[model samples]
Target: MAINSGSDPMRFSASIKVVLKDGVLDPQGETIGRALKDLGFESIVSASSGRIFRLDIDAETEAQARKIAGEAASKLLANPVIERYEVEMAK
Candidate 1:
């Protein structure tokens, strides 16, 4: 049997962007925005599609946390060929 307890000590949060590179165009975002406008969603001034992830880590130091985050971004989060990452740590 598995317990349903939700208590945990690790805490982390990340804001990730998988945008088109400087020379690339984001057709998906543009298309979505246009669709929204067509649907009478005038309140949406602008739209950009991206991903956000929340993680829980065991790192006790900022350096360790950054290292872990960098690994995650490189491995799964951002496409290295067309994207870059910026990591910020909570104090």
Candidate 2:
């Protein structure tokens, strides 16, 4: 394939993982664990809530795509005080 121009948009795929920070209470996770135990899931012990987002971005470069996704995560996808996020980008 021919190389794309600097201005040409390239397709990039990204996966973002957002989770609550340590020492934070996750009532929903605890509830899920309780429900699982009630359902005879003996191995169920602890649970934690987290979110993953898959995004397809059109940007000039992989770095740009990563920056965009990171900015989104920092601004909206996760809370700086209570949550942490990881962004992985691929072409």
Candidate 3:
């Protein structure tokens, strides 16, 4: 939980990362990997594409905030079939 100085609700920020599941094709990541190799980055064998969503939420506790963010991600941010998502509190 967070302690507020006044009557305002406790607010927290969350970051959600959405990525394609393994065995799923990632064309954008492949393109970037090729481009990096062209630039003499041989050690970079592969790349994965993903989306980061930063959200500010007003809640009573950190757990509640995380739950809200996770719910949002599951409902709209990531596709359950081919994509997976992770939610964490933003520093």
Query: What TM-score fits each model?
Result: 0.66, 0.86, 0.87
After superposing candidate 3, which stretches have Cα over 4 Å from the reference?
1-7
Candidate 1: stretches off by over 4 Å = 1-15, 43-45
Q: lDDT by residue for model 2 over 8-77, one digit each (tens)?
A: 6889999999999999999989999999999999897898889999889998889999999999999989
TM-score for predicted model 2 compared with the true structure:
0.86
Tens digit per residue, CA lDDT, model 1, 1-91: 4474454435555444455566556777789999999999999986667665655566545577777887897899888887776666655
Candidate 1: TM-score? 0.66
Candidate 3 per-residue lDDT over residues 15-35, each given as its tens digit: 999999999999999999999
Could you give the candidate ranking by lDDT, starting with the highest?
3, 2, 1
In angstroms, the error of model 1 at 76 is: 2.2
- List the lowest-lDDT window of 10 residues for candidate 2: 1-10
TM-score of 3: 0.87
Error of 3 at 11 (Å): 0.6
| Candidate 1: residue 33 Cα off by (Å) | 0.8
The alpha-carbon RMSD values of the candidates against the true structure, listed in the order shown, are 7.9, 3.6, 3.8
Give me the displacement of residue 61 in model 2, in angstroms: 1.9
